[model samples]
Target: MKPHIVMISPALANANNGNWQTASRWANFLRQRHAVTILPSNDPETWSSIDKPDLLVALHARRSAAAMEALRERYPDVPSIVVLTGTDLYRDIHVDTSAQLNLQHAGRLVVLQEAGLQELAPAWREKACVIHQSAPSLKPIGAACKSRMPRFEVCMIGHLRAEKDPATFMQAAALLTSPGIRLTHIGGALDAELAAMAEATAAAHSHYRWLGSLAHDDVLHHLRRCHLMVLTSRMEGGANVIIEALMCGVPVLASNISGNRGMLGEDYEGYFAVGDSAALAQAIARAAADSVFYKRLAEQCQARAFLFTPEREEAAVQQLVDNMLNSKSTNRNPFP
Candidate 1:
């Protein structure tokens, strides 16, 4: 019989956030081989309706800490895995009590990027493994062949939140003197102040647009058409957007944070200092003007494309699950 797994996620499909996307994708990835059920939260009352899961995978250490602790108490024999997010690794684990406790509670810990493992303490190091997120590849739209108005489209795909650093993109947009440069920001207004700022920026600059809250399909569609992608996020567990861009043969200009660096690699030439609009503006200008530089970024990204394939990700997940399950079970059944 297939093992039943319950995934606890703080956000569901309606949330339309990164956590939800990860939860949703992982559910689809695992369902072919296992019985997977996803719940918004880990409340016992909510889980009472279903049969006890053989394994539990909780996303976000601090957000699901209580549920993890409760699960351990209720099912001592069952093993649990905790997946760390950007906030959990960069912020919460540093100071939050519950997040710290989660490090101790989990039988195994999954970190989305290689840099994430650096954030954990020495003792927890052995238990943690990096699992780079995957996105389905999309064929790049032939911009030269398209009859649409020829503008150098630069796109940023994340909500207007502090961590996402939308302000930097706005500043970069304002600094760009290139009339052909069109900046498109695609995400919902996660913060009211940021939303107002985006609106104000859009009004001041005709080239800058705040196309808020696009569906996943629409975002991928836009991604393929853009000449370049920008990820100014201050933090990321491992940006699925970055992978999507790489998979689509679209290169990225990202902030020089560990998460971005982890995804793009340390030697990637397209990095600017975190929150530095001037540097970002300069980088964008160089990318547009210098054909050699643009080609280099594209070539570098193409080389890393193999790392984010669906087959590789599925194999990693299956191997991790098989090991965890085998460790727990005396029968040592081979993975389905």
Candidate 2:
């Protein structure tokens, strides 16, 4: 018999964000061997309709705290998995009582990257595990298709939020001296002031274009076509975009945060200091001007592609669910 599992995500399809993507992907993975249902919110009424899931996987600690706490109280035998987000690890756990409480209440804790383990308190460390997100490989465009794009096109994918540090990308765009290097940014303007900054920067710089919020399929197409990708987040639990870029054989220039470093190995050469526009500009110039350096970055990223394969992720999800189900102490009627 298959275990019945429920995944609670704070983000829905409309959000088009990482948390939603992760929830959707995991549900797909688990469905092959288990019965899976995904819920947008963790409200008690929503969960009560399902009676009780064999296991509960909640994304975002603070956001889903109420559902996780209530479910744990009502069904103490059911195992709960709490997936930590970038904010939870970098900010919320340090200050938010609810997030901290979620950690204590969880049966198992999941961190998206290795560096996230460092953020957890000692008591929770033993139960926590790192699961690197996966993205399917998209074949790069052929030379004929590539010829249509400008000389060196770099794409950045992230919404306009303070933590994403789009300001640094805009500053780097202004500092870039190479006409051949064109920058394209794709994401929604979550903040009005930041949206204004993107518009102003695009207007001032001939090579810069801000293409705000794109469909997921469109984003993957752009990723395969671009010569390089950039991630400027100040913090990340693990970026799915980085995985997508690597799987597509595209190199990346990321901020030197633990999340980026944890995905791209510490030895990976393409890095710029967080929020440092000058350093980012220099790195972009180097990547565009030097063919050998660009090749090295691509090769290094390709070497890590095996780590994010679908088969590995699927197996990991299956094992976690099986372990949780087998360990359930109380007897209950099996799902049909």
Candidate 3:
């Protein structure tokens, strides 16, 4: 019989966030060789009915700490894997005790981007490996098709939360002078203040629209039709939106942060200073106005497309799991 794997994700399908997407996609990928199951949380009551999994994979160090600890106490020999997220690497691990404890309990650590590896301590770094997230590639919208549209549409996808920095995108909308440039925001308002801000911005700017909480397919459909995508997040482990945008051949204008740098590369030209609305506005206007610059951004994104292929990610995940299961050493660390 195939080994059973139980994955814990803080968010589920209804959340439509990166963590859920990662957990869902990974379960699909691993199901080819193992019996994979995903649980929203590792409640002891919930675990009581299920068999002890051969391996435990948890997303978000801090959020899943209790689950990891519970499993460790009950099944001392079972290896556990922790997939680090932006908050865990850039925030929680630095200040939160639970997040720190997760690092010690995990048998293996997974970072979504290469740059994420730098955030870990030397001992932890030795056991961690980067697994770039993947999205299925979509056919590129032809330039000829885009030229027929009356306006230059740009999109930002993420829940309206403080961490996503929706204010920067809204401020950019207010700063934009181009009559033909349109900005559309897709996401549910997780923060009431930000939701009100989005409503006010939409009412104030004729060129901006906030379409809250679109279906994943609808978001991608809209993304493929746009001239560009913008990501203004304060932090990201590796953004699923960036991968989706890249896969759809929609170039991105992202904040200049380590997570963004890890996704788009250090030399990518389409980055603005984090939280700088004016700079984001200028970048957006320039992309809309300068055809050559716009084309360059698309080309740069296309060059990096191979990194996010499903085949590569699936193989890496399989190898990681296989290595852990086959290891003979009592030490839980699998990667050399």
Candidate 4:
């Protein structure tokens, strides 16, 4: 019999959140060789189900702290792995009480980006590991996307929230009214104030559009059609969108935060300080107008994209699980 594992995350089954994607990916990847179940948070009693997992891998420590605590109490002997998301690292690790407790609760912690470690205390550092998010294999669009008009299209993908800084993209749109560049945001607004700002910013800039919550395929279609990608997020846990963009070979102009910098090299030329709309405008303008600059960004994106392939990610996940279960012995029953 396969060794059992339980996966917990704050995301609902149908939600499009990154954490949801992470959980689903892990479960699907590990299911072929392991007995895995996604732990639902609604019932603590469900924790007592038969075939107790050998390992518990929970994502979003800060947001799912209550669930984490309960599981820790319920399965004190089983190894519990906590996967930290962006809010947990850049935002909650500093301010959230439950997030702090999560660090102490888990036997192991996973951060999607390497730079996230710097923010943690030295004692907790030993328990954390960095795993880059994976991207789907490229379908390789046929038509070359040479822009026919002066209007350069850029897409930003993230749920609209304060930490995502959708407003920074909005602010840059206000400054990008030169008719040479167009900016469109793809995300559901989790913050009403940010939504209003996005609406107002779009209203003010004719070249800007806020597309609230696109279907995954539609978002990928938009990404393939656009000229460049931009992420003005205040914090991130290694955005899967960046990985998608890299695989799409779309150039990115992102905020100079650890998550974005970690993905795009330390010296990647396409960075602007967080909330720097004026600077972002300059980066957008460069990516839109200068072919040489655009080519450089595209080349780099392609180079890094190979690191995010499906096989590579599946193997990485499988290896981690294999190592986690390496010491455990499983039942050899032929029939039950």
Name the top lDDT candidate: 3
TM-score for each candidate, following the candidate numbering: 0.95, 0.94, 0.97, 0.91
Candidate structures ordered by TM-score, highest first: 3, 1, 2, 4
lDDT of 3 at 94: 79
100-165 per-residue lDDT for model 2 (tens digits)? 998887878888888889889888888888888899878867636765666788999999999899
Over the stretch 131-223, how does candidate 3's per-residue lDDT look in tens digits? Answer: 999999999899999989999999999999988999999999999997799999999999999999999999999999999998899998999
Off by over 4 Å in 3: 328-333
User: Between the candidate structures 2 and 4, which one is better when assessed by lDDT?
Assistant: 2
The 10-residue segment of model 2 with minimum total lDDT is: 327-336
Q: Weakest 10 consecutive residues, lDDT, candidate 4?
A: 327-336
Model 1: colliding residue pairs: 187-213
Error of 2 at 92 (Å): 1.0
